[model samples]
Target chain A: MKPGTGPLLRVAGVVPGLWLAGFFLLPLAFVWILSFGEKQGLVAVDIVWTADNYLRALDPLYLGILAKSLWIAALTTVICLATGLPVALGIVFAPPRWRPLLLLLVILPFWTNLLIRTYALIAVLRTRGHVNATLGWASELFGLPFEPLSLLYTNTAVVAGLVYVHLPFMVLPLYATLHRLDRSLVEAAADLGAGHLRVCITIILPLAVPGIVSGSLLVFVPALGSYLTPDLLGGPDSQMIANVIERQFKSANDWPFGSALSFLLMYVTFGALALRSLSVRRPAAR
Target chain B: MTEAVRVGGICKRFGAVTALAEVSLRIEAGEFFALLGPSGCGKSTLLRIMAGLEHPDQGSVFIDGIDVGRTPANRRPVNMVFQSYALFPHMSVRSNVAYGLRVTGTGRAEAHERAEAALGLVRLTGYGERMPHQLSGGESQRVALARALVKRPRVLLLDEPLSALDARLRDEMRLELVTLQKTVGITFIIVTHDQEEALSMADRVAVMETGRIRQVAPPAELYEAPADRFVATFIGQVNLFPATIGADGTAQAHPFPGVTARARGIGAGRQVWIAVRPEKITMAPRGGVPAGRLSGVVEEVVYRGDLSVYLVRCMAGPDGLVRVSRANAARTADRLPGPGTEVVLDWAEDCAVVLAS
Candidate 1:
């Protein structure tokens, strides 16, 4: 190392390392340790051995919640990809002067609090809200048979909210990756006698796989852990594992089971991520 | 003889800037041509117009006598090796070369076979399994060539294909490219700003300036008889002296204490510029050719490996100076002109070009 890279470097790096250890790592470690213990009253049991919590959490009720959570997460990822690819491509194709402005708009929703954004969905989905009011006006003007629509407290509403909130996370990285792609690659494909559609499928799409994978991870993982959107916009049938975990921690006061559920969720998340990296790793290696 | 490509009065404008204006050129079959210019001279833009990647606002692009004004780039029978090579980073070299064939609905085995053969054409056999990033810069450039060649286009456009390589690599690749063109027997249009690369490799060079081609000639002809002041300066280094034409078809350029050249043909009272190559100007001891003599002091001497350059302060104008380069063979330690040493500069009248503008 260089001579002056001593005191200033340690102050800049070591301080952040200490803070992460004290704050993020410590809480996660406590939760992990708590997951291995049994619940007596409001605290864990004295014994440090247990597989029962994990096996019980895999019971029908919690498993059903897991299925619902995975399904919602998968759907949100699909919707984000379907919508975000075009937005990302548009940003990449925009003029250099306009690109930053367009990106700022893509990320604008994140500036508002997540809770406020989710609640804004509720306000819009209400019976007399903007959507229903527009439909009612269209019906009155066209003389079609129509009434006020019901969209609130539905699975569709929950997915719409999830997509709205997580879209920037998917789009920003996709835009960055696509922007780095050489325009000459597309021209080369075309010069090789590939039509526009062929160029997109054979060259552009395959080259952008990294971006798609990253965007999917950004959208899917967070949607799996989401509770507020579903709680506010979804009916009882659509509640995910997070809602169950929230209930165990808050309503039931079952800290041990809640801790176990949290660890199980983390295991599933890491397992899915590990599988994704493994699958994509081989093609990249070649 | 077939005209492989024809560009007719093409003009392109990007907002307010004119990139190409009324540009026209015909590339014959099996010929190698080069567009030589500096950056922002619109050589690339003209090449793009011919390749159908860009459309000219005022004219048409024809390939093999086919009007391809509205035809898309894929429909044109041409391929381009981009300046950066533009190899697909995610795909293996084989897959990248095979991409053109696969997109055209060629069978899988045949595409692979042709791709291999194309790779072999560039002397990159057995490099199919490696990704673009794994290969060296020259290897990637070869793969890009293979990818374009696999499609078997009638015309090949090379956009400064050797510019990315180091000096030694560039020299090696220049010969390789010339040989490759001969082996392929296809029409090749290359764009370059390197004067040596253009002169050494191209059969014919089109010198461009300000969105226009100033002259198109063989490299030797262009170097010997440049059309204008810009061409004279752009093609090679030259010393220019402002002069005036006389009524009796005589021109005068005085770069000495009291001497001038009685140049011919140009009318009187017109301003002209006389250009002479540095090698054309010869230096000698204080008084050799009294008729063409110019007394000057040696300002600086730059002794290059093969030649020595002398910057002389002449007496025609107070601050006028001219440069002359001599071969390193005749070495005289005693008469070596240093700073403040008096000398005479002289050149044959036939060696200079007088231009009236």
Candidate 2:
């Protein structure tokens, strides 16, 4: 509305507009176009517009893998929420001088490469890892028979690795929400004859809905598309959707099918986002 | 009267800062008591200790003649209306008010009915279904009061309940709060820094400073007499000058060689404060025997609607200024004394109190 500011605002928006168009929109369009094409020959895709690739993605074997990936991602999201909520609360209620240190510890994992962290998980969960060795020592101390339990190359390892890598995503959002909360509301509840558990259930949890939703989505979306963690820590039976997509592009030489699977994952992400928006609207409508 | 809340020697420390230092207080049953002080004077800390929200490092809190020092806030028979009101934004007004009853396992129908009755008490009968965001500041304050009162607490604690309202609404709520307290017939303990609010609503006010109680008295007594200089200046406007007492019950100041005022204390050569309210001093045209009067030039005249204040520059007074206020009781031609007018300020023999310096 200011003089000559319309053109000036348009000029300022050009930088991010160009970057998003070039990096995100172009790649997404390419994959979308590839999804409707067919594999004509080895190492090439034909531009014959058809739904064959989409149909092949909906087959029983691929559907089974998608369902398994959803179960794993859902389990990972639940675990992250349960663990991250308490951690965020602890950081929020800690002494003012110690808050920065606790937040730094939560975020320090980001400085390390994900591949290295996943590899570290591999080192920790393998047959002769720290946990099994500790259990062996405890059994010896108790004078009982000792057997090293198999902790590596299972679906459990994949879930464990996913929780570890994605925990900070959950904690950061929950912390941001709970920190901005008016603590006096909790005090008022306690003053009105509500004890600790009642306050947590009636006041804290209901107020933390937005944080819980966003944290779950952040963990679930990335966890569904996880590749390196499952590759390093999961067994053959624990193949997720991302691993299947990789095999379609690499081992099977089928770019069209891989693009179709990628678009399917994008649809799931959109669905989750729609749920979040619906929840936000529900409170506003009230 | 029977005691409702008695906190004895309550002590609390936040890290290195001593927030409360052996504070003690007593509130009679069904009496409206106010802990009045400036911010960070340990009034709110003492209130929290009595509410069981903060544990005292050392002390005992007895409510209704029973020791409740170890009880938690939720277990105590007291509830607080927070300064921010602390209304649950996610709940409707009815749900918020009914929360206390429902939490203690009361039936939903009965809780709803009692909540409605409490809302009616605050004259918010139809606003139960509305969320907290839909209410105004004054409305939210009433809802908070209703929510706390619905539980029928033995004592209600209000932490600056009207501090968030506009000036007009604050005045309105002050009278309403007193009426509601009397109607309920429960002990009420209020914490506030506003002297006018405390003096107007509370039956007894405890003035605090620097983690200690300065004095506790009724409004009239606190205004007419103060225990020390802190209480003297904190409550209302006063003219203060240091003076030494003589054996003849007359106080003498050093600036003017022969000026004297009567003081009832029995000590001689003791340094004390000569405290007189601004309204107690009378200013007239400078032409009298200068025995007990100090002559000065009028520095400024502040014209309020109901009263006028005269600031006189007197060499014989501490800080070189003496303040006198005259009420505008009737229309008069000479009420406006412009600056630079010469005036004589004098008070009656017993108008001032000699307090320990």
Candidate 3:
């Protein structure tokens, strides 16, 4: 026992610890317990233990939706990294005076409500919206025949919305890591006869792995569980597992089945994350 | 013998500050040259220009008598060991050393073999598998050196290569660097601010000040006959006196009793500065002042291990203290003058250097 740390540390840990125990852990424990129960009636569950909910949750229909959700999440993560890495690099290498302003712009999307931002994206992506209208105007001006392009209510729109909403999550961590990168290391690489692309491939990307992993995890986890974007922008075929979970809890009135589905989704997310961490760690440990 | 590098009237300006102003020098092949100066004196800028990392606004650079003024750093036949060493933290020492070769499209096996050989040259043979973060500072520094040397460039530029090490490690590395330079026998240009490091390692040193080269000469010539006052003081401790030359070519200063030194190439009655090294001046117990000798009271005595320095306030010449250092040959403290003890200071007339103001 260190002298000063005894009481103060315990006091500091009390509020957050109690909050996690009350709000987070308690509900998670309740959900786990409910997953084993049987649905008795609408919005009601019997306390009798059963494996029926797990078996139902594993049906091929639900499994297909889970696979679709995984694919969409993976695609969103790839798009975010490809786009966010360049913007992060630009911000990190900008002049010191412009760095704070650029970083503020990167995070400025967070200041607005995410739902409102998604609706705004709808205004741009809809069939009769800004993008199609602009293309119509350009076609008319060029005297070429054209039809309105249907972009909304598609899986592409859902992925686009997810990328737009989660991009900052990718950029911020990458920026934080790139900001501390030693400039002399880049200069040394050039001095040792490495071209610009070679330097990025050999030095910059390898050093930024931690940032990449963290950013990917942040995007992938939230994209997997995203409900609003798929519901608002996706068509019937583009509906993800989150939409099914929402239906189970809301209209279907299957609380035990919903709990089982949610827990299953949580397990899949954890497994994906564990696999990613293992892959990222093995190369670094070498 | 063709010179390895020839820089001609190079000038660079960054915004409002002129970093290098028409700096020109030539480095011979297989020579170990040093650019010695204080911070912001353009020594590092000159080294970067030679490495093709910096562009000169006004002049040209020639490597191996070929004009390479417009070449990019990656295409130049030169490399630099940065002051920070800048070892890639994520890569093993082998990969870090082999990166340059790999970038040039060498086979992986050959690159690794060459990297291992270069590491052996730095006496870090078994350190190839260790990551940069796992090594000590000295080990990382050696890895950086090996990485740069593996390219076998025509010239090597080191920017304050030893400023990061502790005193003991720095001394040991200094000796190793000298031996390495001799074995490799390439044109090595090292930038340093430490006068002792420059003096001990460089075959020729160019002293710079305020973006201009003050003097460039061999270490012995630079120490014994500095071209200007900055070189005289920047290289070592010295006492400078404002003196006037007589019609008979004799120089007289206020601090000395009579004629102190001979002035050459100066008109009669013109004022000049005379510099005398502290070690050249001899201190003796007070007596009647002799001709051309100055007498004063010892103001302070700083006793280093192998030498003792006496600061004497001159009563006969200038209104300033003249410093004199004596080798500590015996354990007789009583024989050396203490504070308030009267002392006489004298130096050979030929030992004083006449300089422009």
Candidate 4:
């Protein structure tokens, strides 16, 4: 309402903010508009609105696929937490000169293409891969029967691949948080007569919760939407929502269904993130 | 009441740099001892060793007559108030103070009782639920002290606990800490680089230098009868002059041509240093007693309200500078000693200490 007030606020903060609104909010609004429209043979009338697409998307078969995707993503996240915490701790406690080297080692795999890394796991877990060959050699040396194990295309392999590809994403943040934790808190716990494990549980773990939660979030949502690892290392039963969306858009030639599936995936990811945001209580910044 | 702590022949080294060298001391049950030193002087290192945070490369440590050399920090009978307080940011003030009790298997009700008592001791009774970040620096420091004292350590160690506070708060906390020690009757070992802090709060001060104890004595004894040149200069502002010992133990100190004094165990022509406190020296008018008198030029005069300090430079032999502070009641606007004014300095022979250089 005032002459110079709006421009002053613009110079202070409002300008860069409106620029983001123009880019991100405008595109999201376009997608929301497209999501509610009806398409018939890819030439539907824009005015004809229907809730049928949403209802059909809730069909048991599609919901079952969504559930499977969520379950696998949750499992992948839990596995990352179990393995990433110690690795993060090790980096945090490392000597000052060695910390940078250890962090670099954890992130070395990320420098290459993610697809390439997942495929590398494919080479190692095949029926006649390095693991089987090593087992065969060991059995022959011990004068026992040798057999090539079947681990190439399975859910276990897919989960393993997901963890490997997303591990640095999980570890880097946890390491940053753990490294910044006040070491005196741990010493104080020990002085209070807490044993080693008690110190870790009460002091180290709680302080590191933010990092753990953030690492889980960074890994979980992407793992849920992942199609590459599963498609390469999984069977038909292991196909995730992203694989289904890919199939609908490229192979099925059903534009309306594909658009509906895309919107549904976005909605589910948004809802999960919203729930996560509500659950993890943030510490007040200094 | 306990015997408190005994540290015997503790030595520590970080690679080639020896941080603490064979330091030994005993703390009484209820005395407040201070390790006073400049930065890099290993006072904090010794305190950390006593707290079990650092392992002595050689020697043993005991608390309440129990050998705790191989014991972990959690098993020791000592607690420390870190310089930064190190209070858990996620926990409230009450929880932070109760943390040690809770982890040691105390029940919630009992832990809360002790925590409340400790908080009350530090005068923070109603602030239990406030987070550490919400408290002021002084309040947080008090909370840290309460946290350590709540555990009832046989000996409480504080590493520059008041170094983080502003000057006014530091003075207030000094008084509070001394009173708290008396009230609790627990042994307190505080490490500080502040000479005034050491003099004002400690029962006995151990002055450290270059990873070793220079002298350990009462604050008055340490300042009045320093054992060496380092202790004399470090404790307070002093004027030192190079002198030589003569036969019959009478040493002719320079700048005072005929001034001689007794020096023990010194051969003739051996170099020695004479120490004189600024307040101990006096400037007199013309026709003053001529014996034990030194001649110097008044370099500068600075008025500090309560007293005025005159920096005088001796022109002959070993050019030493002496500071003389005159009381404000003796202020004079007439013929004040300006720069380059010839003046005579006189002091009793007992006021000056002669030491081997």
Best by DockQ: 2
Question: Which residue runs of candidate 1 sit more than 4 Å off their true CA positions?
Answer: A1-5, A12-18, A41-49, A126-150, A276-284, B255-265, B286-299, B316-319, B329-346
Q: What is the descending DockQ order?
A: 2, 1, 3, 4
Model 4: how far residue B59 lies from native, Å: 2.4
> Residue-wise lDDT of candidate 4 within A184-223, one digit each (tens)?
8887777777898998888899888878888999899999
What is each predicted model's overall lDDT from 0 to 1? 0.86, 0.91, 0.90, 0.85
Worst 10 residues of 3 chain B by lDDT: B252-261
lDDT of 4 by residue, B24-142 (tens): 88777898999999999999999988888888999888888989999999988889999989998888999899999998888999998999999999999998999988999999999
**How much is the lDDT of residue B5 in candidate 2?**
93
Report the lDDT of model 4 for residue B213.
91
Query: Chain B alone: TM-score in each candidate?
Result: 0.92, 0.96, 0.96, 0.94
Question: What digit string (tens of lDDT, one per residue) describes model 1 on residues B84-108?
Answer: 9999887889999998888888999
* Candidate 3 residue pairs that clash: B254-B317, B255-B317, B255-B318
- Stretches > 4 Å off in candidate 2: A1-13, B256-259, B264-266, B287-292, B316-318, B332-335
**How does the DockQ of candidate 1 come out?**
0.75
Task: Put down candidate 1 lDDT per residue, A1-286, tens digits, no spaces.
Answer: 8898898887899889999999999999887777777778665454467877788898998988898899999999999999999899888888889988999899788799999988888889989888998888999999998878789988899999999999998998798788888999989888888897788787878878888988899899989999999999999898988988899888987766788899888888997799679867967566
Model 4 residue runs over 4 Å out of place are A1-49, A132-149, A276-282, B1-3, B258-260, B288-292, B316-318, B330-342
Candidate 3 local Cα displacement, residue B82, angstroms? 1.3
Considering the two chains of model 4, state its CAPRI-style docking category: medium
